[model samples]
Target: MIPNSGIAITIDIGDEHFIHAPKKKEVADRLLFNALNQTYGYNTVDYAAPIFNSQEKKNGGIVLKFKNAETGLYSYEKLNGFEIAGEDKVFYPAKAKIVGRKDVFVISDDVPNPVAVRYAWRNWVVGTLYNAMLLPTSSFRTDNWDDAIKAKK
Candidate 1:
């Protein structure tokens, strides 16, 4: 940070007097901005992308669909943490997929059969949802799964 041109508000606390000035970015920020500019296809990656559903109806309510602003789901290896729910609202973690362009199908693995599925249910989870490029997938919750917050709380 630099001092304001000519006159400005100045104050002295305990250690030293402070002068208002034009804000300047730190080196780390400059480095990141530079990296983003130089990095290959940076726009294609989203760290915390948002997920929105399409109003157009499809196969059925089961046809829960959304768009990944990015090209595709990132897969350092394989994406995971998909889960399912029945009418009872029981959520059991299951397998998932990136079909076609943006649709992700969360299959009922443990439950064998299911009605609805949720992805990345945990808050502040490290990583799970992402395009094949490893960009973080949008955070979401499938069901108010019974006891969803109860157990965690």
Candidate 2:
């Protein structure tokens, strides 16, 4: 998860007031981060955990199960780059969609008997999945293959 924090300023004016600032989006984002981190005392609001524990092969695809899903399972704003691998251990681009259950998703690339699934598992890609809290899921892979990127580094 992206580390963030917030700051709280007290004014002796003794009244609640709304302050609007005309700033760039990124500037506003930074301010919001600091405000949230300072107010919530870190790692409390909109926190996400990577803990997918179950996977199943079905309908020429892979099904990922997220247990104890709070805020209803959902995807992010942009297209999520998903990859799937079969027994041959070669990953291919795939797409993810929420299936019957809120905590279940079907990732499909049409690979027969898919064995593994990953989401936004790249150095720079938009994440597509989130929980009810609107916290983005970190890049992750279900395979245990030698990390080529790590090896190169």
Off by over 4 Å in 2: 1-46, 76-79, 147-153
Scored by TM-score, the top model is: 2
Ten-residue segment with the worst summed lDDT in candidate 1?
A: 5-14
For each candidate, the alpha-carbon lDDT, in order, equals 0.46, 0.56
Estimate the lDDT of model 2.
Answer: 0.56
What's the C-alpha lDDT at position 130 in model 1?
52
Taking every candidate in turn, the Cα RMSD to the unseen true structure, in Å, is 13.1, 10.8
lDDT at 25, model 2: 55
Q: List, residue by residue over 11-119, the lDDT tens digit for candidate 2.
A: 1111233343233453445456555655566645543333476787777787777643554667645335777777777677777776653554445544667788777
Instruction: Report the C-alpha displacement of residue 123, candidate 2, in angstroms.
Output: 0.9
lDDT of 1 at 42: 68
TM-score of candidate 2 against the unseen true structure: 0.60
Off by over 4 Å in 1: 1-64, 132-134, 145-153
